[model samples]
Target chain A: MLGGARSGKSRYAQARAEAIAGRHTLVATAEARDAEMRDRIARHRADRDQRWRTVEAPRDLAAAIDAANGADAVALVDCLTIWISNLMLAEADIDAATRDLCEAIQRFEGQLILVANEVGLGIVPDNALARRFRDEAGRANQAVAAAAQEVQMIFAGLPQRLK
Target chain B: MLGGARSGKSRYAQARAEAIAGRHTLVATAEARDAEMRDRIARHRADRDQRWRTVEAPRDLAAAIDAANGADAVALVDCLTIWISNLMLAEADIDAATRDLCEAIQRFEGQLILVANEVGLGIVPDNALARRFRDEAGRANQAVAAAAQEVQMIFAGLPQRLK
Candidate 1:
């Protein structure tokens, strides 16, 4: 599921994943780098309850997914946007990340639910750096959409199936 | 200027605009529809210190820019990714948004600073919608980078000039 901040996209995605899978594994991309983030993470964790086995993978998402793959497990990635931002800040190669992600998705043996933020409908940023980030995020979204079986956009606490 | 979450991207952009041109205008894409978001908007206003003019335009960014254009006023867009997400959720034409953003940049008459989140270089999303968003953000970044005079990536609260 994809949507703006606090759009209930994540909740919708989690509910969908829970309905489809017997065993749920949530791969979280967020890092508790600050108190506010830590609190937010805690709230999300509480919201998910104890049914999910959480894997915190701030980096090396492919490896985490590879390790978590199983016939009975449904893997749900809470977000990709934050992970992308982390890599960009780290000065990692975006193409490499794309390739790694695609490869991981191909190798996975079970159903997967990936969440991401849609980030390109706004005004053009003045600085080149922010602009580049937006462009890269857009590219990543397209590649995943091409591979995904279903595409949904969540807004105002509602889900609109796009693909 | 960069900061985590609410860290000073908008404030810095506004300050930069005020420094370059005494009178500054803000292009706000966030819709204040909920208490949380309303709080966010209020915080942004408080941070701006009353030196800047604000224009709340949730969509049709090009028209907003045109309406706010002036010879001596600097234009500052608080964000781009959120606007893009809004469009995606609304099923708005992504191509139109891209075209309009580029046109606005090409025709901008004064200094402008834009805020955006880098959303590529992360784990591949499992669903089609997320993948599409990542791809679109990437493409948008490339398009803007190709056209913009400068490009930068903000990481760890620091700016890295890419172009």
Candidate 2:
């Protein structure tokens, strides 16, 4: 799943995951840092209710996914963009992270829904840092989408099936 | 702005945009391809209220931005990732789209909050297409981040000021 802000990508991915398996595991890539964000997290948590087990992993997503894959749980990676940003600031190698994630996806046995942002359709950025981020994000989406059985683009809260 | 699924990135960005400017314009990058997605879009529309003008633009973001720019309206680009994907699939030269977006950004004089995904932190994709998308996304993020005056990362619905 991928799309613009508030494009319903997350909700769509979550529904798909829930439909696939009873034991749903949501591997979150976000870390709460403020009061506003806390509220948002709470809302999301509430929306999922008790049916989904949420794991907060700002880093080390591969390990987290592997741990969740032990059971017959359907793993849903809700957003890879944030994970990438976290890794960049943490000084982790982007290439290494991508490689690890792909490997984990290949090894996992249960159903998976990997959600991400498709961010490459805009203008070229002015500075080197911005350009670098854009390039990495583009690569990440491609990798995940390729691995995914179905690729979807959500716009205005609508999902367009891509692959 | 960027974050994981249900990470509050969109709300944070929306609030920021509302607080900073008067007349608001939302440049959407989703294509609305499913029933679930339609509901998602409706939710977002309700969230935004009737104060802002919405533009349905799945491609040619530079032109959309150009049309949205004016003295009374501030452009809020809710995302860049989907736009990139659309370009990658539709346009022959993705780099040209990047260049056009950047150029438009440079010329725009109003308040613009451009959201994008950071995609380089995950494991390297196994296939060539995935690898290429990751690389392109990274480049795009870096470019936009460098160009923008401020950059923020959202995690677990919490935002970290990174600029």
Candidate 3:
């Protein structure tokens, strides 16, 4: 699943996972780095039911997905863009991380849904860093969509199939 | 049609218009304010064959559309987001302009295709003006979409129908 901020991608992905009868794991990539992020993270958590088990993977998402993978498990990675930011801030290899993530998703035993932001539609950002981030995020989205069996873009709480 | 930057929306819109055997008008909302923008606009203009007639409508799009409308005319507004920015810079009434533009679209005697950007998917901007622009752009997209007979989103040269 992919969408803009407040486009209800998380809710849509959550509902998808909740529809399946089995274990649920939320591979959270958000770190409560600031008050805004903290509030956002808490709000998302509040939306999920008690059946969810969240594993924080601000980085090392492949390991997190591996740990969460189980027979009959439904795993929702409630975003990849944040994970990209985390990797950028940590000076990690993004392409390698994305490849590993794709491999992990392919290897997963259960259903996996990945949520990412589509951030390159606006006027180009002014700063070099923001421009770079936008490029990287877009690249990751395209790569992930290619790897996934189905890709949907959410806008105004509506899902449009992309793949 | 709506999409991110360089997402092939213009190409897709142009192709759609070209498919219809009729007169084509490109209702351009872009202004060559800088070298980059000038180059981009020139490139887009070069993509069209001699069959296309261009009208520069940085603002006052309804009038431009009305003027361009004719029998067997296929008019494409290759974008609303830039028009929104132009209106913002001019301190014009965005809501009112959007309403007028929609009415023009509804009344148009030609095949009309509108292009817009999905600008709200990224991390929130640090500046208030950008945030407002994002909000305004999103509002325009939803409103325009509601008025459109059909809607499609373009990504990486691919077209995905949304409605």
DockQ-sorted candidate list, best first = 3, 2, 1
Which has the greatest lDDT?
3
Model 3 lDDT tens row, A36-68:
999999999998889999999999999999998
Give me the chain B TM-score of candidate 3: 0.98
Deviating ranges (above 4 Å) for candidate 3? A1-117, A121-124, A132-160
Cα deviation in Å at residue A136, candidate 2? Answer: 0.9
Which digits, one per residue and each the tens of the lDDT, describe model 1 over residues B1-163?
Answer: 2222322345446655777845678899999887756986887788776667889878788888887766775888767766777788889997888789888878887776777655664456666777787677667667667767776554322244667
Each candidate structure's TM-score, on Cα atoms with residue i matched to residue i, is: 0.51, 0.50, 0.60
Per-residue C-alpha lDDT of model 2 across residues A100-151, encoded as one tens digit per residue: 8988887788887888876665456666666787788888888877777788
Worst 10 residues of 2 chain B by lDDT: B118-127
- Taking chain A of candidate 1, what TM-score results? 0.94
- Tens digits of per-residue lDDT, candidate 2, B95-125, equal 7777888888887878888887755443444
Give all candidates' CA lDDT scores: 0.74, 0.75, 0.88
Superposed Cα deviation of residue A136, candidate 1 (Å): 1.2
